[model samples]
Target chain A: MTGALAAAAGGGCHIFSGCGFPAPGLQDFIWTPFFTIGQFQFTKPMLLAILSALVVIGFFWAAFRKPKLIPGRTQSLGEMAILAVRDQILRPSLGRKGDSYLPFLVSLFFFIYIMNVMELIPVFQFPVTSRIGFVWPMVFTVYFLYLYLGFMHQGAWGYLRNMIPAGVPWPIYIILVPVELLRFFIFQPFTLGVRLFGNMFAGHLLLTIFTLATWYLLSLSVGLLYAVGSFALAIFVFVLETLVTLLQAFIFTTLTATYIASSVEPAH
Target chain B: MSVRDRSGRDTSVEAESRALGLNIGWTVFSYLLSGMAAYGLIGWLIGRAVRVEILFPVGMLVGLAISLGFVIWRFGKRGITREETSR
Candidate 1:
């Protein structure tokens, strides 16, 4: 009887065989282009990034194409959200003179938000941001902008001075200088990239595992508990992942604004 | 010190002191909690997936290392002054 029950429980394992682990060898998690004429061999992540960009542009274009006098539903909703980020997050952090950087902040916010939301889509289940290649480009973009703006506003020396906090003792400068340098040049972009990458990577992995577990456990009589547990965890994680998708985008945009603001303001 | 100068300095000093405390506390707390939660979750999941104890801590360390790298980089650069320096 015990053996029979175990056999019945193990029956469901066949349903989850293919979906358990990531793909094997070079093809694992990577989508290679079928046709490559020259040196340009497009990968899955790159294609997804491009798609994300187009979707962002398309959404805004459609919503703002025809402006109403009083403002229509979609246009008004979109415009209001954009304006809120501008006024509440960017403006306050950046101050009055920082208005010029609004376009970049807006674009970054929507671009990231759209890419994040891609994970929830039916066919495009994988988020492009989960891949390091896609994340590196975005991180570098922010890094270059911050460096450029800092130099433009304060010049080289001024930008350096902006980094060191005032009122430290002379002897402490030795330790503080190197720490500051490491933070600005190396740490900022690294963290920004890792934060997004880590969150999305972990979230997707959890979803995959739970999904497979759910299927595997449903195969036998004694497996009902496992199936139920897996299902519950999967649903819980899905909701959290959705919230994280939005939160990450917000955090990235806010940090960009803060970085820009720091560049423009005089040292205290 | 004179009374007026002492009072003015005291107010500004108190404000700066408060801000510094708040910033430090907030940063430490936020990173610590998030780090713990992330590592715990990853460790649990990996243990379940592979059915191995080694992978649990290994996964936790990997996650921790990544998060630490980020926090250090983001906050470390704030102290540098980027203005032109005389040769």
Candidate 2:
């Protein structure tokens, strides 16, 4: 669909060429790195991701640096954000026992949220999370943390036993073992990364399609009517995408907390 | 664990529970998909070596059944117990 859209979008330029619509596609996703040092290429997504991390760090620092009994405006906003995540997202999945992980969860939520919010910003229209390159590493770290927690809390063999459950007949063990193994080992992290990437990628594509269509269809005749409709849809889609971005960030953070909760108390 | 909406109009315990239920459903679906893909691939290879086409589908079915059983064990009503459900 994206490829087709890109081809059609390209046709918009020719007008008289009666060509296809020039929409965004897989090619638009592939970026030329701003610079390369050896094998490492610094791309736009990389810059956005780094900026997101810095933004999160800077915000928290400014919010908490004073340690005031009565927080000012910035500090109050920061406290609300932290408290909201704690009560709504983490507390539900993890409870007070998991309070130690609050910092990690807060950081993950804010960083992903900021990266997702970049889509609506004028200069940075592309969402960093839309890039799988940015998502996999974060997911991998969460994966590793959960695994470590599982091993630490459950003991080595205990973790495996907890994962398998018990009382299954020996004959059924063959199928059950592999299913359990693959589900926990691969699917959890894979889905985690893919969920964030897929939401952002699809939302970005939808916005691009509507916006491009509005531009391409803006001729003087009947095209103007179509353009108006397209423009309205574009605005509607853009508004929907903001909610999507926020929801995806929340869901990702919630799931991370859930995974940690399960890992820490595998039997539960 | 209770969180009021931004409007401060209503607590979201019900909504949060629904979200958790949906999260469990998604996890179950992923388990089924991964299980089938894993064993099905193995079965396909064996079937090719043995010149049999039936094992691939057989593998897929077996994988689905195993994952379903796992999901039941992990998420059945009995699995959560009273303590977790209340939370």
Candidate 3:
């Protein structure tokens, strides 16, 4: 999508020109594989996902490589980032007792945040999460962890029993039980992935549309005015995407912690 | 046990409430979705068997009502308990 839009803009696909508007669509998300190994096709989003992981690891390693009584600038930044996730996201759900899960949550938060932030960076304008494939594994891991923890702590039968709200009449349980089961086993994990994917996908598509429109509207005539408006809107959408990226990551990590907390402690 | 601002006012309560709000919002949405989907599918299956097409939409309405009733009972119970505690 990025390269295609750039080409169209450079090629002068203006409104005055007979050439139709090169509207961005799902094709924008479909990239030619950089290389192929057997049936596996390596693409830009895959590279971005790997690079996101490395960026997270490399930053933390540089920050905390040498233990220091007095922290350096990098360490301070590292501490600030981790503490933000811990204080704002993890603790609100899990409290002090769940401190052991801090490293996992921190990694998840930064990995997701950086992957999303990639959409804003030059030459890597695609959000990896917009590809639902990347999101599901993360969602499934959290789902598995919480379910495993639930069974481990509460016993399998007890865990199932705990999911049902107590004091509800026996007959109502027929309906209520299925609803609760669907909510926990299916809907929770499904929504977790869908929420992140939908936000990134829609945000990227919107930015693409406005940006392509800006280029397509550019002309010597009154079309230039519309082009300028489109350009401004493109900039606005770009700025909004930055906040959306972070907010989505926060929501994902917080929900992960919430699920874990629920598993460790039964529903009230 | 609670977080505090620079002025030393505890902010954990506010944070917890915000978290609760987020969870509740999602919970409500999921309940509505699950109810409609579950009952709607059942209705579709039964309607297909009986050759009555109206049951699909009817099923969805029934599901929505059941979910709404359950949610009200569930949270309304908590609300009543809180009121009693304050008294």
**Number of clashing pairs, model 3?**
0
Name the lDDT value of residue B30 in candidate 2: 80
State in Å the error of residue A103, model 3. 0.7
Give per-residue CA lDDT, model 2, range A51-73, as digits (tens): 88999999999999997898899
Q: lDDT for every model?
A: 0.63, 0.79, 0.84
A95-186 per-residue lDDT for model 1 (tens digits): 44566787788888888877877878777766778777777887899888878878987899988966755655677455345445655676
Clashing pairs in 3: none
lDDT score for residue A1 of model 2: 19
DockQ of each: 0.04, 0.29, 0.29
lDDT of 3 by residue, B1-87 (tens): 567555332248756665666666677788888888888888999999999999999988888888899888766656532111100
**Alpha carbon deviation, residue A7, candidate 3 (Å):** 5.7
DockQ of 2: 0.29
